[model samples]
Target: MNRFILSVSFSLALGLASALLPLSSAEAAGPRCLTDCTPRVGIVSAFGAEADILLAETTGRREHRIHGRRFTTGQLRGNRVVIVLSGVSMVNASMVTQQLLDHFRVERLVMSGIAGGIDRADHVGDVTVPDRWAMPMEVYWHAGAGLPSPCGVAGDLACLGLRLAVGEDGRPLPPFVPDGTDVPAGSWHLRQNHVLSRRTAPQGAFFFDYPVDAEMLAVAQGIEPPLQRCGPRATRADGSIDEALCVRQVPRLRVGGRGVSGTAFLANARYRDYLHHVLQARSFEMETAALAHVALANDVPYIAFRSLSDLAGGESFDAEAGALFTSGLAEANEAAVTLSFLEAWRRRPRR
Candidate 1:
């Protein structure tokens, strides 16, 4: 009887051990659920300084790395946030934005950065929240009449526009004359989605002009001091501030205007005028339009806060003002507006 009782006790102990071993294995394997419980807001910046400012204020932070990019997940002013730097370009911005959306539970996207001032009314340190963003770089090239002459009218044409259409052989192609007989040679046209100024296009194409979320825009509007009057001064190597580059005029926020984005860093007066007059853009940057496009494609709500770092080509031929002074001020103003918007968003009831 004693031997039988001992045998039964040993079997029971073995069964208990088997049950506990599975639990230990499951715990060691990590959580089965990878999804975040809380919805996250995505904040993107193109520059290091801009990311630094936002990340510095975040709390309960955790770092993530995917495809060589670092995404910082944290809470800013009671709101869950995911912040990342979109390297300065349309492709870079679009790729990282898609990654963030796929990896996290991001409900909305916000971009805060500095841009070249396209409108004369806007100045350095002034923040702009545009209703929409346009891309002007995507264009169709029309072949020139022929090889441009070195002087006179041909030279002028080449200098102004024809040079952009020249082939690698250093010769201009024949003008595009579409005829029923045959398609014109050297005539280039982009598919609808790649073109800019979709509003002007005859047919719907994936053209430019991505609108910001109206509700998000309203949130930005409600923030106090949306505009700034003055910009911060630049510090010299000796730690002295450069007064010449300082903007004494108080900067103010301008809401509900058009913003343009392109890969080129524009610093030409003619191009700047074209953006302001033709495109009706108040601000021009490198990343916002790309970000907007990605967000829109994913059906995610989005907004941008852009501060004027310098007049695209208005301040100086070499863009001295932006390089020497306004960048810091623009960065600071953008960060301020972004933080204010996040705080207000946290307080607002969910839709």
Candidate 2:
């Protein structure tokens, strides 16, 4: 009798262990019943610092994990929401966004983060909710002297407005080939920059501008969230206040313009000016455009708010001579704007 009872107990324990294991591929892929069926607004950020403010304020939060990534479901500004970090680059953004969509009942998507400001006139700490986003780095890097110059008379149907990629000093950059490649296939020069104002032939019907959801954009437009323009004020050991990292002007919110993204961390001023002039790009970052792409494919209404952390071409950390790298308020300011937008959205009259 004791032996039989022990065998039954072992079987029950084994079944319990199996139930707690991660779902198998086929099971996870199906539209199976999730433990939580709550419809939530998805808030995506590229990294921890950007998501930290929102995460801190989230109430009634519950957490879940998939393949080690955390997806937190919670209430923010009186709305049901799910928030996750999409990691850092364009590829990371694409992967995590697809995962989030597949696993959650996400009704709408909202993204906010710090970004490189393309125009010098646009100071750090200011927030911008771009009307459209694009992956400007997708391009055919022309073979040096072989491809027809789009600005020249030989420019034809294949030209696709090809322009010489320029440097920070506004000089045309010399093209170079990648280290490992078969020479017989023809040498190809890599252009870190590209002109994406139009589509390349046979890459049929690709978009240079993916417009954000019009309705969500309209909601953001009416929101006038106050933003921080300086670093966190802290007390010294003697209780004296330490200086805050202050930018040139009071941070303000601008609602429309194009925001461009690519794998590159932008530092080239000449390229920055070109994008601002050619594409009307106001912000540069690594993730938002990719997130926009994912949201569009999933038929989800999406919007992103980016706060300028630095002048893209001008102020890197060491290049702080002119105080251009005012490493403050960008994350907090964007988060503030996003939370305010959420509040406004919750209060918006239902259809």
Candidate 3:
């Protein structure tokens, strides 16, 4: 047996191995697994819509289970392949990755999802297999202000209730632009690609928020955990990560228009240090780091597959972002097809 083959006792686990046994490039490509317990392969994504489509088409399933619910798990080529939606935020992502590992006992974890591109050279729809990623958690603060006055309050000030803003330097900036004034949309602090590159900054950065998948070697040694959270901290009203702020922040990174581009000029302590530490960091995602954690802990031969959903640099989720997301999915499907066929072909019983 290949060193990677896993032993599973779950009904779904059984189904997955059985379906995969007659593995061959051609056979694997034909259909996917039918049950959850039998799934030898595991895929994790943050986007539920993308996960649902991929699972159903690849595994050919109309219904499935997750967290003991009738929540659907899809298929691939008539074989059972478990698909999970880890939600949008990194915390949610970490939680989901841990949950899947516990429930599935998957032999291998394949993290397929979208990520932002960081360099101008990387246009919309470009695909990147990031050697690793950086993950960051939010540290929030609150501001004090007077309560709002009702409509009829004679002395009420219209701006009293407004939330004040601060910059990274921890100094306040003028609350809002003058009513009739306009400022140029100046050049965003864009930089060249430098993640894991030699020129990355060295200090003041927090420890790796997200680990690089390629560094599976480090994960097995117990020197690190599987999940690595990266990216900017959430800056919400009162300077805390409230529900609305949390939602806005998570999606912002996924679609990729903000954040420092390239490793050329990282200002975020966490980001600069991440680049310095994990020279292998290439792409960014919410789930793969968590997936890496579980796989390493379980001794599974794991591989994280990500299709670029947007350029990591810039500042907004635009039409280009949409193109990248769609294109990345297509590429991931193709790569999955290729991998399944190769594994199946190798597993076929010989005469």
Candidate 4:
């Protein structure tokens, strides 16, 4: 009887030990457990209106909630796809994209949305597929000295070799300089093989311009979807078209230019000109750069299709332009191009 009891106890102990063992890396990755082995392309948008259009087009979708965000997995244009919203800004975009990468077998990443037009040549409803994306809002806050005198002024106090700018209020304006530059006011400060100190260490600095996947850009360039020219006119509450708000020209597709992202909703023409001249950016939005940065870090191919919803405050700003007219047209154009790209990818021969 005692021998039987000992044998049972030993068996129980062994079972417990086996249960305590950690899972292997392959087992830990949830995708391995899924029955489907097909790799999925990730589709990200900033908000519901954009995502809704894609979701409607996707078939056989199964919804899954992770980290409080809804991800729909299915086929779009016959390509395996997983669609999710990246929220609205840089932080939200980066976080959701990383989460998607962590939980899914995302083969590639693509974003489709609306952006403020920065290029004078591009009109509202035009879809732009930029070759690169950059964050223009990343800056160093150089607290300028209160007085105009250079002495004791924050502008004169060079921290990390950047001079602060004076504000209109007679106080120091935080010097808003691009990341990874050592140039003082007018002259460039050249340093050869300089070691970085703790204070001079690179903070919030990135390559600034992150290029889209070359092959993906080529595929996008090849897509020739028919685009909408004029957005529907804004209507009064009674549903009559407001002729004053209608955009007259047919919107066209522009491929291979630069896109920029920032936290601000730019409305000033002067700042728009600065972005156009300095960065050569065609469109400005709030999310694409962050998504590009995340994708680049992961070595994942990334691309974005952005339709112009507004002029970023140019030529008599119409605050109601997006909601009243351009939003639907932009979303439709983006979806059309994205679907076409998927078809192109399907037909391309695999290496």
lDDT leaderboard ranking: 1, 2, 4, 3
| Candidate 3 vs. true structure, TM-score | 0.44
Instruction: Please report, in order, the local distance difference test score of every candidate based on alpha carbons.
Output: 0.72, 0.72, 0.40, 0.71
In model 2, where is the ten-residue run with the lowest total lDDT?
A: 189-198
Worst 10 residues of 3 by lDDT: 223-232
Scored against the true structure, residue 121 in model 1 reaches a CA lDDT of: 83
Residues 254-308 of candidate 4 have per-residue lDDT tens digits of: 9988898887777767667767875577999899888887776566789999888
Q: Write the per-residue lDDT of candidate 2 for residues 8-31, one digit (tens) a residue.
A: 999999998788665665443433
Estimate, for each residue in 166-263, the C-alpha lDDT of model 1 and write its tens digit. 32364432233334333454332211233322243443234447889999999888897544443444667787767655666667778898998888
- Cα shift from native, residue 299, model 1 (Å): 0.6
- TM-score rank order: 2, 4, 1, 3
TM-scores of all predicted structures: 0.69, 0.72, 0.44, 0.71
The residue ranges of model 3 lying beyond 4 angstroms of the native Cα positions read 1-39, 59-75, 133-280, 316-319, 322-351
Q: Across residues 243-338, which tens digit of lDDT does each residue of candidate 3 receive? A: 321211112112222121121322233343343232324454455555554444444555454544544433455554443333333344324432
Task: Using TM-score as the measure, name the better of candidate 3 and candidate 4.
Answer: 4
Better of 1 and 3 by TM-score: 1
